[model samples]
Target: MASSNYEVIRLKRDLPAQGVVIHQITDDRMKTGVPLHDALDRLLEAVKGKVLLVHYAKIERDFLEAATKRFYGKSLPFLMVDTMQIERRRLERTHQSIQSNQLRLAYLCQQYQLSK
Candidate 1:
């Protein structure tokens, strides 16, 4: 779902025994300011029954926590898997080096050959 203030990308795939859906929420409301609950609502609707949430960082978790407080009673239930953490694990396991002071995703992707 694409909105003027935000763009939500959803991908669904059916494995041999299970179904999975992934949601990517881009924060385009930097100036206009979209509500956290609104974004969470869209995310919840997209991954209502999926197993995992693959997000770039822990921002999604913080967003969900705030949204849950905003809604009070209604919130989605799911586990958040930070892609950053996954990459960090892979780099540590493989003993990759960080040349500079930056820990960007591009660097991690290159180290892990996860770039597309």
Candidate 2:
């Protein structure tokens, strides 16, 4: 559904000047934030014919499916590449010992020398 009343998420960059680069969504924002369906509609339209690359699929898949079903009363059909699974498979194939944190997005990115 098309909507003009989407929630606006504001990020204050002033904290970064004080060396705090990570910003957390405050309780105020959480309570005021709109449902995911609105954003999902636009995102799905924009990413048509594009494969989404994500760190973990479970969370993203769950959220997308839930939103799609809730808003449109239909299933969401989309392609997604889970980097965490890919790295896990690679490590398993190479017979390397997998650490608990090895499959994490940040850890996998570090292994592949990806910049933050």
Task: Show model 1 residue runs off by greater than 4 Å.
Answer: 1-35, 74-76, 99-103, 106-116
Determine which window of 10 residues in candidate 2 has minimal summed lDDT. Answer: 13-22
Model 1 TM: 0.52
Off by over 4 Å in 2: 1-23, 32-34
Best by TM-score: 2
lDDT of each: 0.53, 0.69
Clashes of each: 0, 0
RMSD in angstroms, all models?
A: 12.5, 8.0
Instruction: Give per-model TM-scores.
Output: 0.52, 0.71
The residue pairs in collision within model 2 are: none
In terms of lDDT, the poorest run of 10 residues in model 1 is 13-22
Q: Mind giving the per-residue lDDT tens digits that candidate 2 earns over 1-116?
A: 32223343333322333323233545455456554556676778876787777778988788778878888898788798888888889989999999999987677778789753
The number of the candidate with the highest lDDT is 2
* Positional deviation of residue 97's Cα in model 1 after best superposition, in angstroms: 3.0
